[model samples]
Target chain A: MQDRYVAYAIDITDPDDPRVDNFRNLTNADRRPDRPGGKGLVIGEGTIVVERMAGTRFSPTELLGVPRKLNELQAVLQDKNVPYFCASPEVMAKIVGFHLNRGVLAVSPRPAPLHYDSVLAGARTIAVLEGIGDHENLGALFRNAAALKVDGFLLGPRCSDPLYRRSVRVSMGHVLRIPYATIDDWGTALEALAKYDFHTVALTPQHPSDTLADTIAVPKVAFFLGAEGAGLSETALRAAHRRARIPMTPGVDSLNVATAGAIAFYERSRLTEQQAK
Target chain B: MQDRYVAYAIDITDPDDPRVDNFRNLTNADRRPDRPGGKGLVIGEGTIVVERMAGTRFSPTELLGVPRKLNELQAVLQDKNVPYFCASPEVMAKIVGFHLNRGVLAVSPRPAPLHYDSVLAGARTIAVLEGIGDHENLGALFRNAAALKVDGFLLGPRCSDPLYRRSVRVSMGHVLRIPYATIDDWGTALEALAKYDFHTVALTPQHPSDTLADTIAVPKVAFFLGAEGAGLSETALRAAHRRARIPMTPGVDSLNVATAGAIAFYERSRLTEQQAK
Candidate 1:
């Protein structure tokens, strides 16, 4: 039988300890994933995200939290020999440079990014994002992808790092759960998607186009979404096999990109479920 | 012919003028719509939101911006004769307490909150929210509502004020575009909703209930969503006429309540569109 007790579960009294250095000044520049020289470590806050991180490609190398969190993760920590740097709330806050309402944080090195071809290989319904600079929007999109059972994500140009700390926090850590890859070739990646039989549908409100529901029955599809205000580039939109609209009342501006993606993903999922039934 | 000239436009060089105090420290306590001493002013940032506010119930009482934004709104500003508190970018930033990237700001008092009965009356589909304290999510939901054509919004207990600055900013000013009201009596409001022949559809993943597509055909429906972490409270859930779920993968937490609402609203809109066809 495996030894149920964990030796690495050390109670830390000092916030200055080097053991939890990976978590220091978390909200500041040195830890900012998009910044140069930043480690871009995969951080999981709270038990749920930590538990989720445990099951993903990004494995936690260290855990920092209150003792209660250690108790909660005891079952998940049974096999790992990684250090659990448990501390008081004050100590943890001092180490992290802010009060963490989630009470625990797990830090992991980012795994290698997936190749565009590899991520697109099995995805039946994928979200292709362009210039989505907001970390929360990027994270929220990942959360939506995971919940709606979207196959994966494709990163377009000008998009922010999905593994950034704020993205990880806002996505409720679904950024760790979903697979994503950057598209360096921009519109050229449309050819790769087409080769895989994905109907590249550009989501835009520019002029009359097919409504989202009309695109549901298409066998396999990828919705290309641009940043909220300035949508897909003309080159990118031209690359798409088709264009679709969310069908709004005449005068309102388009929906936020993530919200639009959610509706698109939901439509695709509905079709798949209906087909299954 | 109307004598059209730029002479009516006054460009100011000062930031501390009392005329612009309504737009000062905007992201703070006194400007908060929910604060006790809060003036409950609805603020619009950027040319787009400013244009929207021009036609919304929250009429702009004061306008502050750079030359570019003032020029963009010149036609809309023609007849209003409102104070165009113009400034250079540097001065505008000092007044608003931040670098105004959107380049313009319009301040308006909150329109009277809609009557609970009035917003719901004659509505084919709407959304009811409870304990949704996150302003961004609330704002995103309104943006989604505008896109998906959800008729209006009904707020239950503990929901944050939708007119909060962050919500307005995150919603891209859709809060000004959509009509919404607070339901003070909690579950008793469900009875009033029923009187309007509305089916109160609780959006929860817990129940192995009807899928959203299956229920979208209901003539009059109100989709109820709760906060992100804790879903619909027992009272909110029990008060629902039916529980409908978006089909999602097992063990995954439900989609963000606002995203879920978008899907439900989109589903209803799609159904209505199909019937119209």
Candidate 2:
């Protein structure tokens, strides 16, 4: 099975093939953020994301695309026995129930989500978001998290499903690359952060707060952010070890929560770079 | 005209009422990027955004909402002659072609765009975007520009209309507050910026470039950002006085254009603050 290049190039002509059942009802299947079962599959669109999927822990079990993308992705499929279901863009659209301009898509079964302890075991910097109900924001937070080298993400109450189609697209598929887990217990689950020697900093606009620049000194840290309009619950804010602010202009609502998170992550990276120097 | 505060509120039972014509086609109005009159009007949704619209230079000619929102907006409209066309939520939904959960909407005629010289005259820092065709990215850039204290925006080729509805909403109505204009002459516009003593910097991820942290000496600067996928044109990058990067992790595409812009704005702000101290 691990010999030379080989991909089962299945020609899919029928839109209603049961083999492609998981890919149907895509519009509704990708909605419903609250149901865990609704978000079981990790989707990768386009050749780059598919290639990335091939290399990551999340292996692509099925590839659905026009022949052009199949040829484009052949180099990356050399080692895998994955099925490449070639179909016309029209047939592919009918099977997926929508037009996918990316021209190709791959699907991965969900692996066990990384456990909190395992994710935080040796992490120096992390991001925790609460009530970030918007898929784009959640996706952006992951992109920023990956760019700034945050070790992982901790999702709190009311976060949208990270595996949703819009999120995967907006995140440029980074949601799959960056690890995350839920923390419904708020402070109690957050207290475990302290056990990892992480200084949990609550990012807020209120006073009695240190600027992000001033608070990046802790060796291990986790910056907490809430949704943009309805921010962190008071309990979540009070439970953090320190209160930090990004030092914004007066009268402006805080930067979009993900933008604020990017700044925090950048500041933390600055500390790591400085130490290395 | 000043005494119009006591005017009777009109009830609109019909969705197709001509008086509410400015609010029609919420979806298609903002579709085109190149045409001058593609979008119908500057739209502001929700109370906070509506209030911002009232406070800004964009004048709201008509409003559609439930009576409760009318009550909430009383302070902002106390003296305006404009009629608040109060309707039941159902009627309002029919008029707008959808149920606007914000429960209120305001439409403003586009104001004469600010002259480049006038908008640039007193600015210490500015943002320039090229080919940022996504309405959400354009809007979120304004939101970040506002929060980070970037004084103004300069639009280059292929950028979407900043006053488009989704852009306005995503910017939290900051699109109305921040002044922006299209630059027709490309690199020639860099000369006008030079007259204002702006240190023009092009943001790119390419190496052998100055890091954003290293480009902080100039008190007045203009930062250039490209669209998400197709970044700055070669001519745009070449015309800039300098080039800089935000220092991202390996194997990641550049940050979302707005996120990258925010980080650049943050770097500029941090430098300015440090110098002030």
Candidate 3:
């Protein structure tokens, strides 16, 4: 029987070493895994996110950190045979092209994308996102979804890659754990969801007939969210089964996209828990 | 009566002009209004925030922007006699030490602080913040407070000043509109709150007996929130009349401070509206 616990610790004093090229120049836009010219690496930062990535299906291919963080992650690293590249903070910062105060980073290749049908198979409540282009907001939405009991995320259009470095950090690494898939066609996606008996709720501030709390008691539900200023596209809104609004003060502009989603998810959780009781 | 509609449009071509000194070096830490050895100037950015400042007690003492923003703000500027300093975007960017895409900026002298008693008076729903030192979270809390009909905010220990430039921008200038007062003594503040018959509910993740929805129905309610990782202090938890929590999925960490506060505020709004209906 092969041993599951394999530890390979490599100490690299040189910042320009090719062995650590995967962790280089992280701030450059072209280095983003989702971009055409970029290496499609899933980067996780900080101890918590790094630990989470180790536990997820996307195993870290390599890690670069100061001695302290490497020691902290020793337990999680024990089971994996990945190389742990130990370097001083200065060398690590030089290699990454920024002062990464988190003192730790792990990089992995993107995992196989989850199928929409699989994500929906046993899901009770989900978030269907359209045009959530901001990485921080997208990550925050995933965090909210995880905390509020939404089962998964279904990306419709214009959503940034959830595995992006900033998203991973901002989400507290929740993006790695929460299952997600992208839809090529909104119309077909809605039709597919309807066939699965999911009630699609489009959240909008404009002319919403029902409050989100009123619409959250369904057996299967998906709340659709949009970008900050433009909101959900008309086609996406029309495709949903129902429209709901989180009641707001009359003169104030709409809530931030993620905050609005959190309210919807919270309401769903509250209602479903009450019903269960 | 002295004319209130005086328009002083100054076109300064030099970045080092002393007249626009107040808007200079915005990114420098020493320029922070809340920091020691800093000029105590409240700065507002973008058209929306500047417009909101015009509508709030924090009146802009001076304004700087491109011609486009100047034209857009004409209606708001008509009633105020403050100097409107217009410059080219390039020149304005040099003066502010960054390429501020917002295209507009406003500066005001800090207003006299609000009294805690005044903030609590006539308020039905309020947020009491402890150790919310993050400027973005502090600002987002104010924005959420404004949207969800929270009447005011009471600052406990270690809360950042909402009037700081980053907070002002993040709050969408809602911090200028929301009434807030600092509490020198938490014990006395609690006593004062009790005199007004406000239910002091501390939101904690540890062993909360009642859910937020269960406690939000009071005539007057105050939700206490702590910083992100370190929740409400032990002193704060004991100081509250009751402890309530937002139920979460097991094994997940607590929600972001601002998001948690928003959920609590949303529940309060929902319950109050339901009762009113």
Tell me, by DockQ, which candidate is best: 3
| Candidate 3 pairs with clashing backbones | none
In DockQ, how does model 2 score against the reference complex?
0.70
The better-scoring model by lDDT among 1 and 3 is 3
1 versus 2: better TM-score goes to: 2
lDDT of 3 at B6: 42
Off by over 4 Å in 1: A1-7, A11-14, A29-36, A186-188, B1-16, B32-36
Candidate with the greatest lDDT versus the true structure: 3
Quality of model 1 by C-alpha lDDT: 0.83
lDDT of prediction 2: 0.82
User: In order of the candidates, what TM-score does chain B achieve?
Assistant: 0.94, 0.93, 0.95
Query: Residue by residue across A10-59, what tens digits does model 1's lDDT show?
Result: 77898898878898988785665557878878788898888888888977
DockQ class, candidate 3: high
User: What is the lDDT ranking, best to worst?
Assistant: 3, 1, 2
**Cα lDDT of model 3 by residue, B190-265, tens digit:** 8878878899999988895588888778899988899999998889999887899787898898899999999998
Q: What's the lDDT for residue B73 in model 3?
A: 83
Model 2 pairs whose backbones collide: none
Once superposed on the true structure, which residue ranges of model 2 sit more than 4 Å away at CA? A1-5, A30-39, B1-8, B30-40
Flag the better candidate by DockQ, 1 or 2: 1
Of 1 and 2, the candidate ahead on lDDT is 1
TM-score for each prediction? 0.90, 0.93, 0.96
lDDT of each: 0.83, 0.82, 0.88
